[model samples]
Each structure stands twice: as C-alpha cells, then as structure tokens.
Target: CAISQEELSHARDSLTSAQSALNNIQQQLSTSVALVDDTVVSSHPDVKAAAAQLRQAFLANARSTLVAPVTGYVAKRSVQLGQRIQPGTATMAVIPLDQLWIDANFKETQLGKMRIGQPVEISSDLYGSDVKYSGTIDSLGAGTGSAFALLPAQNATGNWIKIVQRVP
Candidate 1:
C-alpha cells in the first residue's frame, strides 16, 4: 500500500508539472495574439504600400474619364470607344465658343502703342468691311510663333539679317 501511494503521488506531480507547462505555453500564445491585435492594419508597412498603390490606380482610372477643364463644345473626336490612347495623344478638341478670342499676330514695330485691354477693330473675310467687331486685347503671347516652331530655323550659317518677330 505504501509503495502504491508513493507511485500515485509521483504521477500527480508529473501531471501537475505538465499542466503548469501547458499554462505557460498558453500564456505565450495569448501574448503573441495580443501583439497582433494591438497592431493596426493601416499602419502596417505592407498594408500601407498596398493602399498607396490602390490610390494611384484609382487616380489612373479617374484620369481615364476625360473631363474638360472648361465648359466647351466638342469640336472634334478622333478616338473610338475602348481605344488605347498613348500619352500626348490628340484624342479630341474642345472649343469654348463663348471664350473664343482671335489671336492677332502683330509686328514688333506695331506693339509700341498697343497694350493689354486696348480696344481694337476687327473685320473678318466672312463679313465685309461694313461689319466691324470691336474687341480688347486679352493677353499677349510670350514669344513669336517661329521661336516655338517644331523645326526652328537654323540661322547660324546663312546671311542672317536681324529680323524682328511678331507677337501673337
């Protein structure tokens, strides 16, 4: 009986030790889970990167929907539906008829007395000289058309006379 009691006590001790070890393991697992719970997904580096990518994609999708900067009429359309457009593509033209102002290129010598908001008389070929349109100079162009031409003139070699350019 004494030997059996000793064996039984030894078994109980072993069981207690195993239960304590299990409790410690459970505590460690809970601590790990708590750390995960404390972390916010938005603050996570991977999640934040994904969110930034999503924002860029959303902006790209919004860009696909073309919206005119000003209220205007669609002058021309060159692109078809679902057509892949490249960057700097001339897809369409918008003409603001109400804001349409004629850009007159005047000689550099002619700009001495001219100033912005100066009223001027305009006559078009469509209308005879009898009909004149009164307008004010809205704005002057920064440079001449030749200066901004796609293929600018190479004036280094030829007999280059200093010619005054027109401002539009």
Candidate 2:
C-alpha cells in the first residue's frame, strides 16, 4: 500500500465514524417501524389530539354563525362583537316581516258597527297621511285600551277624573 500509516489510521477513523452514523440511522428506522401497529392513523394519540383540536375549531366556527329560527331581519343581538356569552343564551332577536301585525288603536266611539274582515285605510307619520295603507280589520277588542294600559288610571282613587278610552 502506498498510503502512510498515519493516513491509514485517519481513513480508518473516518470510516468508523461513517459506519457509526449509518448504524444509528438504521436503528432509528427499526424503532420507528416498530412503533407502527394495526391501529388506524386516526386512532393514534397525536392524531386524536389533532382531531379533537380540529373538532373544537369546527365548533367555534359553528358558534360564529347566527342561525335565526325565523327567516327575518336581525332585530337585535344581546351580545356585542367578541363578547363571550354562555351557551343557550338569548343572543339575538328576529322580527319576521312575513308574520307581522299592527296594533292600531281607535276611539271606542269609532268602532260603531265595525266587524271583522272590514277593510281599513291606514296612514303613518313616517310617510305622509297621503300615503294610505289599506288593511283589513282582523278582530275587535272586548275591552278598552285604558283597561290594559301600563299605568291604568286608578279610577277608584279620590282624584279620579273623566278620560276618553281607546280600543283596538
């Protein structure tokens, strides 16, 4: 051999180092293969944890969507943006225009001979009185509005006074 003893020794040391690296890699491969089993990928602990996190993310995404029971405009949301509310909280209100009713009050004297299904001409201050809205009288009230007013005049009191009552 033309190589010197020192060079041969150095080459041997390099070869030994390379062999050690290869052995370590091969051992790692064997260990990795042993870790694989008949369990499905989803059944692995790490995969399960990831799947749980994914499910939590999906739930969070679902929570962000406000699905009203009725197909109507969102009248209100009790909670503000990014506000944390407990589950089953009443967070929104919907006013379905399709199912709406107007509570029109009229003087008791005006309801003379009025019956259900009577055509009514309505107007609002929002639009001018010229913009009349035609509607039908659904039903008549049995009592006057003063009877059900929030602050019903204590008529039985000493300061009782005469007041005209309205009806719906």
Candidate 3:
C-alpha cells in the first residue's frame, strides 16, 4: 500500500529514536562489563582490598583445618582446639639443639672495660666449673637496663643528682 510522505517521515523518525535508545543501552552494557572485568583483573585499590579479603578468608579456612609444615614429632603441644593464636605469639618452640647461646647480664660498671671482640669467659651454675664456653663480646647495650625500663625516671623538678655515665 502506498503511504503518504508525511506518514513515511514519521515512521523513519520513530525508527531513529528506537535506534538511539538501543545504542544507549548497548553503551551502558559495555560499561558494566568493563567494570566487572576491572574488578576481577585490574589492581585498583578496591579490587586489591577485595582480593586481600578473599585471601584472608582462604587463610582462615585453612587455619580452621590445621596442616603441619614440617614432618616432626610434637615435642609439646600447647594449642588446643578453639584456642586463639595471634600474630607474633609463640605457641611453642622447636629446640633442635643445633644452636644455643648464653645470655649474661653483666653490671654496667663491668661493661665499662668490655669492648667488641673482647674475649669472654662464661661460667654457668648449671654446669659448674666443668664446662666453660670461651666466647667474645658480640655486641654491647646502647644504654643501661634502667634507661629502657617501663617506668623511666622523670626529673621534672629542678632537683637533680649527678650519675656516673659509663662509656665502652
């Protein structure tokens, strides 16, 4: 059927508007897909945060089920089920006896004469006189034990006292 020129123009205008709407919807869909891909592959802050959370969840799941890293006998088990183990917390120590050292707390006055690489004669009460480990001074303290105390001395008032400082 032959249509009027005015009706044909209206039909063409309607088709053009519908095409514009379809193009807009397609653009939005493309943008949504790109965002989803970025969330999975891109290393943005939000993506990294989500990945870190997923990794932590995986670690927590693994911790819920314990798996030993080394094949060794349980020298002494301290952790029980449902017990919490925080970061840097020592549940137990594996003493292979392959390495050992003696911690000696010499007086501040005695350390005055001590120097790096100086020979040291260590005598333990447990071993008595039978065993003596001859070693050298590895390192010295920066300050006295009292300096790093929990409750450090405070001299807020004008009252002061002269203390002998040692240097090594």
Candidate 4:
C-alpha cells in the first residue's frame, strides 16, 4: 500500500494545524491560571472596595426606614412623598397619649388660686363635656405671655393701656 503525495502533504498540514491549536489552548490556560494566582480571593483591594460599597448600600437602605422611639399615634406629619429630608429634622410629631401634659395659658387673674401639686379637673371640646380628665397642676408660669412674646408690644410709642396678660 502507498499513500498519495497530495494526501501526505495534507496530513502534514493537519498535524501542523493541530499543533498550532494546541499551543493556542495551552497559552490561554496559562494566562487564566496566572490571573488567578496574581490576585487574592476576597482580600484584593478592588474586591474589598466593592464589598464596602455593598455594605454601605445595605446600611443606607436600612436607614431609609424610620422607626419611632415610643409607641404613639403619629400626627402633624410634614414630610411629603419623594421629599428629601435632612438629618435631625423633625418630619412628624409622635404624640404618645400616655406621656402627655397640658400646655395651657390662662389669665393671670385665674391663676391666682392655681398652685403646683394641686388637684385639677380638665375637659376638652374634642370629646365634649362628657369626658373629664383629672390631673394635678404641674407648675405655674412665672412670667406673663407678653413678656415672652416673639414680637412684644413696643409700648413706648404713646398710649399707656393696661392689658390683662395671660400666664402659661
């Protein structure tokens, strides 16, 4: 049996092509292994940076939720949907009914008999006169309302009139 000259040349060319392909595959494998050896797993700077960014994103997402410190009914909320709120800003009032006190202002004349620790009866128009609240007079105001007003009356202009001041 004898091989043709054309077939012999073709076989030589095929062997050369196969060897070239094998060299290419080996080079690719070496490059991949070198890349893996050069860089550490999770301790690489880029990897650590990416992980830190992920942790920061998780923390920011967690902080997006607002939790009230006390169990209470929320009221007078000023924040709107999609509003950008600043840090330490009061977005709403958490009015805990259990921990509440009356902040009232009364005429000075009416406070004459009022004293701290005195038993007082309270009522609100919200519930009509049917609901009565019992409490003690916590404290009395030492100053009049005009004295603590934001824009106190500048009485130096002319007329001297006696105004009945209210006490808090």
Candidate 5:
C-alpha cells in the first residue's frame, strides 16, 4: 500500500506538469492569432502595406497604355514603340479644330471700343472676302505682345524710343 501511494503521487505530479505546459502553449497560440484577428483585413498594417504595393504595381503596368481625355484630331505623334518617356515629355499633340479660336493682334488704341461678345467680321486671304466668317471678340488682350516678349522693351533706358504697341 505504501509503494502504491508513492507511485500515485508521482503520477499526479507528472499530470500537473503536463497541464501547465498545455496552458503555456495555448497562451502562445492565442497571442499569435490575436495579431491577425483584432483588426479588419483592410485596416491591418501588413495587409494595407501589401495592398499599397499592389496598387503601385498596377499603376506601373497601366503606364504602358496612354488614354487621352478629349476626343480630337491627333496633330502630331512623336512616341515610338517601346520608347521610354520621361515625365513632362511631349509625346504627342491633339488639335480640336471645332474649338479653334483666332488670335488677332490689334493696336492698343483699337481695343478701347472693343468689348467682350462684340461681333466682328473676319476675312482670310486664303479664303478671300467672299467667304466672310462671322466671329465674336472672345477676350481683349491684357498687355502688349512686347510686354510679354522674351526680351521686353526697356523704356526706362536713357535712350528711350516711343513706339506704337500692338496687343493680341
């Protein structure tokens, strides 16, 4: 009976140690799963970072296809197949002839009576006066062309020259 009691006590001790080990393993597993379960898939930092990388890759792939916003005539195309274009590079030009506006330059004095929406008659040498096109003054020039030139006229110089200014 004494030997049986000793063996029973030893078994109890082994059972307690096993239970403690199992509890520790369960705690570790719960902690690992908590990282992925507490938050939504989209809001999780790891998932969000992965989604952003996928979006960046999608944009990089989409750069190969060029989509123009407006429907118009392609005046010129300078892009070649498999050509690498830098940012802000001129690839092509689209000219919408339907929305064309004529830029007419006139003397500064001539713009005094010119108002917006005023009707004007236009005659081109190529089309002749027989094809007189009716047009309206869209906008008046803010300043003379020389004022916005690459090298503007210096009237403040000691040898200043008075000249008639033309505005467009």
Candidate 6:
C-alpha cells in the first residue's frame, strides 16, 4: 500500500522532532560533563589529595630507586637497578627480630575454662616438647569459626532441626 503525501510529511515531522529531542539531550549531557570536568579542575578534594599522595608516592618511588626504608644485607634482592616497583611490592622484608606472636588455634571446648586474666601455657610443634611461650588468654572470639565461614548455616527454614552451637 502506498502512503499519501500528507502521511509522509507527518512522518518526516515526527522524525525531525525526535532528532531534535535527541540533540537537546546530547547537548545537556555534554554540558554536564564539561561542568564536572571543570569542577574537578577547580575544586576537587581528590585532586588536592592526589598532590599530597604524589609526594608520598614519589618518596616511595625515590626510596625504591635510590634508597630503601630499612637497609639490611639485601639477602634476597628481587629487583635490579632500573625496575618499576609498585607500592606494597615486598622487595625485601626488614626482619628486625624484635617480637612476634604465635597464633595458637585452641579448640572451642578448651576455651570454656579459659578467661582473659587466666594464665595459660603455649607449646609449639616446631619446638617440640619444650614450652616456648606462655601468655594469658587475651579474649574469646565473639562468634564461632562457622560464623565467618562461606556458607553459614541457615536456620530460617521451618524443617530445620535444633542443634547446640558452640562459640569460642
């Protein structure tokens, strides 16, 4: 079926109106982007913070290039003279041999007799038989290990059976 000239004219007018609306929207978006860019240039806290961060970064960069934070014998030197090192990039650890804590994972049952002020004995498997370090129990965990587990038990179901739970 052939369209009348009048219908074709109306269709053209509709298309032109839609195009005009699109153009207006585009102009508004462009203006908004420009405004945001200008704001970033003028009064951005992040930009100001970036300047300070760059100083710290440069200090880190300079340390990586010329000097090091903690100079030792350089036991394990991973990087050569001119290598791009990133932040938190463990070039070498400064093992001061100052102090360290032994992470002892006591069972949930044993924790019942333990208290914050209660004295306790700690033995290391690496040391063997001999008691290495002794310390008081700092605190009990607020929740059990299963609390932070990936798939926590869902007790929301009506068909769920009752079970006694233990917490450290």
Among these predictions, the greatest TM-score belongs to: 2
Cα lDDT listed for each candidate: 0.88, 0.83, 0.75, 0.90, 0.86, 0.71
Any runs in candidate 5 off by more than 4 Å, and if so which? 1-72, 80-82, 86-89, 154-160
In model 1, which regions exceed 4 Å deviation? 1-73, 80-91
Note the residue pairs that clash in candidate 3: none
* Candidate 1: tens digits of C-alpha lDDT, residues 86-166: 999999999885677787888888888888899989888897898998888888888887887889778787796878888
Which candidate number has the best lDDT? 4
lDDT of 4 by residue, 38-141 (tens): 77789888989999999999998898888888889999999997788989898999988777789899998898788899998889999988999999988888
Candidate 4 lands at a TM-score of 0.58
- The RMSD (Cα, Å) of candidate 6 is 22.4
Q: In candidate 1, residue 168 scores what lDDT?
A: 74
Question: How would you encode candidate 2's per-residue C-alpha lDDT over 1-168 as one tens digit per residue?
Answer: 499999999999999999999999999998888877455788889999999999999999997997766778886768898888887898878889677668878887788868899887878899988898777888888888877778956556688666777897
RMSD of 1: 12.7
TM-score for all models, in order of appearance: 0.46, 0.60, 0.39, 0.58, 0.48, 0.38
> Over the full model, what C-alpha lDDT does candidate 3 score relative to the true structure?
0.75
- Of candidates 6 and 2, the better by lDDT: 2
- C-alpha positional error of residue 75 in candidate 3 after TM-score superposition, expressed in Å: 10
Clashing pairs for model 5 are: none
Question: What's the C-alpha lDDT at position 124 in model 5?
Answer: 94
lDDT of 2 at 55: 97
lDDT score, candidate 2: 0.83
Better of 4 and 5 by TM-score: 4
Candidate 1 has its poorest 10 consecutive residues by lDDT at: 96-105
Which rank order by TM-score, best down to worst?
2, 4, 5, 1, 3, 6
Better of 5 and 6 by lDDT: 5
Candidate 1: pairs in clash = none
Sort order, lDDT high to low: 4, 1, 5, 2, 3, 6
